[model samples]
Target: MKPANKFRADTIRRLIVFLFLFSAAIVGFGCSQPILESNECIEARDPVKRFYSFHFGNEMLASKENIEKRKKYLSKRLNAELNDRSDTKFDYFTQTADYPKAFRAGKCDSTAGDRVKFEVLLFWRTNEKNSQRAIQVEMVKENSRWLIDRVESKE
Candidate 1:
């Protein structure tokens, strides 16, 4: 083979290898990218999670002061209704007098207009026994912010 032709062949082979590596890198980068959640889902899910974190961390008490502290996460009507409850023994949010030790908010469902629902799991630890309950949390987008509208037992 001629020297010039051999040089051209070597260059072509290197170029092919480089192009294959570049294409593989591009494909690998694309696949490794994280899947992003929709803004609406984030907006809907964050407030619920934040509220539960605050609630559980605050000794799971739903007193008037605690309710007032978390008023930002509550709807106007719900806040008013909760405030009106004279008996602090019964927690309106958890719908139980005996509160759970912790809670987790599930995925947000935004099929309803301006409303999202989350399946919240409530956990209780008592005397080496553990119990859990599922509740449906309904939130409404009010004034461009998501707020807890209502809670119902899934049972």
Candidate 2:
């Protein structure tokens, strides 16, 4: 083969490999984002998350309508999660804590649209004599972000 032809062939080969790897990386990157984003944006603005922090005197957890800013974010989780257990006995304490320890997340599934489940960790420092446990929060995605739908004390 002529020198020019050999160089062109090698260039084409390199381009093909680059394109394939680039395409695969893009696809792989795209696939993981939705899952990470759903949880991140939600956790960043989750109502229960707000509630957890508010107890720390964050004030941003207030659900009062006049405070449109905070209320707006709360609306997402409030409407979906609150309504379901609104009538049930719930603790609405507003106590400040030393800090929110690291949270642990469990299995999460979001293949189906409109509804998805997320296991998250949230902690609070209480003056109670008993040991403080990591609270397991079950969140549901309502508008592209997860919302705390249910909460349980994880043993």
Candidate 3:
């Protein structure tokens, strides 16, 4: 083939390869995190779903690192509600060594007055029928952002 034609072909191949890789990277990052809406109200409609997606979407619940990270995050969110004076920490995660394969958002209710309050119930299935569990997620608006102030597993 002609040298000019060969050069053009090589450049086109490189450009196509670069575009493919760039698109793949973008898709991979988008999947890694939950997409949240700027409208806190819309996102607040299902705090449990959001919680599950952000907190328990990847690692097993029993993983110490995961548990500690979740606990710290919750504690930070609740500190304001605790008036920055409480040493107590709250947790709302189910603890089973068994890994959770799937979860579905259940019923949810919210109240609007000053700081909006949302209670979201989430259900998950592990390996045992007895493993069915519900989590109650409590959220309040802070600085125009929806924050999960507390979470408690409904025993």
Best by lDDT: 1
Query: On residues 1-155, what C-alpha lDDT tens digit does candidate 3 reach at each position?
Result: 99999999999999999999999999999789664433544666554456567665655433345555554334355653444332223333433344455566554455553233343434455456534555565667655555567656666
lDDT of 3: 0.55
Query: What are the lDDT figures for the candidates, one per model?
Result: 0.84, 0.49, 0.55
Q: Candidate 1 local accuracy as lDDT?
A: 0.84
> Model 2 reaches what TM-score against the true structure?
0.34
How many Å off is the CA of 2 in candidate 1? 5.5
Better of 2 and 3 by TM-score: 3
Q: Candidate 2's residue-wise lDDT over 1-155, tens digit each?
A: 99999999999999999999999999998887444545443453455455445444544232433234333334365444543443222332211233344344444555344444445554555587433345445455567555455455545
Taking all chains together, each candidate's TM-score versus the true structure is 0.75, 0.34, 0.44
TM-score winner, 1 or 2: 1
lDDT of each residue in 70-135, candidate 1, tens digit only: 899899989998888764676777878898888888766775668888889888999989999989
